[model samples]
Target: MENFNPDFLEEENDDLYEHFTFTVGKGQSPLRIDKYVMGKIENATRNKIQTAAKNGGILVNDVPVKSNYKVRPLDIIRVLFTHPPHENLLVGEDIPLDVVYEDDEVLVVNKPAGMVVHPGHGNYSGTLINAIIYRFDNLPNNSSDRPGLVHRIDKDTSGLLVIAKTEHAMSHLSMQFAEKTSEREYVALVWGNVETDEGTVEGNIGRHPKNRLQNTVFLDDEADKGKPAVTHYKVLERFGYVTLVSCKLETGRTHQIRVHMKHIGHTLFNDERYGGDAILKGTTFTKYKQFVENCFKVLPRQALHAKTLGFKHPKTGEFMRFNSEIPEDMQQCIEKWRNYSKYQELEE
Candidate 1:
């Protein structure tokens, strides 16, 4: 079992960062602390673990331990890092939001595409946090700059998100997301016709070594390079070369869905960061190329949307679900693909 303190977790990107705790099994034998911990934590290197131990970030039975400390059976071990990697000063603005449902404890909003979820470097203005603060005051804040945000979707992904209004609500909602009990479903259009109706992608996702801005799956030799990530997906519709799919996240690593889908050779359509902007599938005909270009113009960003979100109300313990209509640009692009797919069928 894992234990995380609510006060230590910071809402950043999608997954909230917090301390990690592990209880040693009764059958476990004595071993070097660094070696034992490396085996328990995924993607953790011996060097990094040792460094953390030196920094007093590793603890055994509530006391700081050194790299060479011997671990005994049934010992409680913890790796705590209270500080977030990055935090920007929050500045509230009067940007409008499409509030879906608001109660004393929670608020659900349909976030539009092209809106940043929180304040961060180079994104200090016109963010959802700015809008949220402008509209509602006295909202609970996490260790990071984001206030009331329990989880987040990418800036270009339109969808439903839940905000906590009180401290209890924040802690409760954060626990749900951390436990992976809250439901989140995304709709995406990928470049190829995915052969499987449904499937799961399992891999360790880490930042690309050459491009820090991109994320990639590290497997085999680099298996210990990043955190474990899993994404479950089902085909919703097939539009010739491009297929529409719905994805459920089992783990919310940064860019988990986008990176996992790409790992399987079906990069989300128009996802420029992952090399999906160009035509990765279909014929190379001039007219086909032109059609794709026009479709790209219609939908300027990654063809993914957070369509459905489900979770139990923190205060009421009642199940709540919300769905958002696909944005107009993506809708128009999907219609264009539908027509194009039919035209190709007729030619065949």
Candidate 2:
């Protein structure tokens, strides 16, 4: 399978994060899975591979396999570990944070727009992790340098995130996310008026084969191409040219909301990656075009935000929930659309 979106590689509140995968070649001879994987993956040790296998992270054709399991020709192998790859050493930066709640086991932060969750590819420093490490000491984490991260949102998409401060918290929170007991809600402005009050979108989401940077729903016959993902959305409000919707994720796939909304012909507004930046639904008037351009200027990135998050407390059995106000740019853009929608009605 192609690479999954970084944001969806691991679900929210997951401890066993998937970072690498390998496929046995057609001519490959039968060999122990751990040994076979060790030869293919760099910086991996026997101990780590065995431990992952023991934890049910090693999968052959989507089924968990042990380290001693023999890898046959054409076997698809996936290795998911709790820790991220050891790339650049983590260095704490004194960046400010919008902390909402804190306890002995967890910390809730309202991440702003333009902050990547972890270091990857071209983004190494100046991430949320950097800020987190600078403020806190010894966060429990195994994956790439993102310590204590239970879930993540795209850098451009702002929202609430929960961090595990201790091993017990991390394990407990991971189970909750993995079991799909956690609740996450997003507010978004999408082009076109949504016809329904609420609906669900179910599809397999994976990386676009032609464009690796973007993701799409797999409606084709290629069954093994993507992973199953579900997103439930409710129309919160409707503007003449665009609509504001609340999206709840059932399975947190990479770019799940963006891709699912697009699949249903209602792409998120100003999402440059999935082609929402273009005017998908609007009038042909020059005034309308200019108005949209101004809106884009106000919110240069995707018009999506993680508005609410809820899960059971790791230490206490009581449930906890948090909500965040929409960022200034998105809020201002929505207001512009709202006024325009009412103005259009008055004109008619």
Candidate 3:
């Protein structure tokens, strides 16, 4: 961990600034107060908003409110940003960090499975951001509390991720990711043997109407209303009944790999949102069917791991790469599949 100057503002002077007003919308009802204010206020961080609400800067129908206060339809929410300039926005906690590489300008961390990248609903602390705040006094201001985070990995996905330490580094890295110049590769354990060695999945991803938490692929007509997503996959290993694959992203969307894999009839193992469970059940191999069911019960999340990351160093303008091995649980699942395959061969 390295110490850096804190960038959060500490105090506000009424003589120096003016107040702005924003109204809450119906779509924002039931959302956390901190999140609601963050959405309405430009350049305001969640931490700042939370602090303001705690100090009575937030008013709902002319009443001071709390950060966790849930909004109701047509609620009139007002925020008065009158806080002093503070340099330290987040407190550093001694949360564990799997450091792959570290430099003055950036850090590459091997994020463990089941760790959320940043704070959100039901998770305000113990996140990668919190750990980074502890390690580095502060991150660049491009993203408020998030500091140097340029991209994100799913909470259940283990892999390599990079963070920028300075504003210049954050901007440079973000541009690379936006331009698709950064190479991100993921290793996944899919439910069935891929019929081909390589393939591409291109489609639009949008929220599921029936299931709000899930994303679905749509066509050109439907895609107009959806976000573009693209994934390129190559088979890495074949186990007769299951396949190990590596996928690269051309475009990143929510659950792009899981959704695209499912669209092609080869969902990642243990993926609850997609069709992985259903596909496993349809396998003709009785041994694989039983293995998948048993493994599914024990595995906590989908078998997707980000194994490699490649991009130019934000500060140096030189190419750099990072890699992380699969987590133990996923590796064990692969080993079990191999052993089961061997046992079935003996029976044959």
Candidate with the greatest TM-score versus the true structure: 2
TM-score of each: 0.75, 0.78, 0.73
Q: In angstroms, give how far residue 84 of model 3 lies from its true place.
A: 16
Model 1 lDDT per residue over 191-288, tens place: 99999999999999976756667889988777757788889999999997999999999778888889999999999999998999999999879999
After superposition, which runs of candidate 2 have C-alpha atoms over 4 Å from their true positions? Answer: 1-20, 24-86, 142-145
Best by lDDT: 2
Residue range 1-348, candidate 2, lDDT tens digits: 244334532443167766667776565678899887776554568998999888778878877777889998778888888776434467888889999999999999999999988877567788989888888898888454458888899989998999999989988988888789999999999989899999999888976755667888887576566788999999999997799999999888888999999999999999998899898998899999999999999999999999999999988889999999998999999999999999999999
What's model 1's lDDT at 257?
87
| RMSD in Å for model 3 | 9.3
Q: How far does residue 239 in candidate 2 sit from its true spot (Å)? A: 0.6
Residues forming the 10-long window of minimal summed lDDT in candidate 2: 4-13
Residue 92 lDDT (model 2)? 89
- What is candidate 3's lDDT per residue for 201-269, written digit by digit as tens? 999886664555677898876645457888999998877667889999988797889989888878788
Between candidates 2 and 3, which one is better according to TM-score? 2
- lDDT-sorted candidate list, best first: 2, 1, 3
Local distance difference test values of all predictions, in order: 0.84, 0.86, 0.76
| Error in Å for residue 245 of model 1 | 0.2
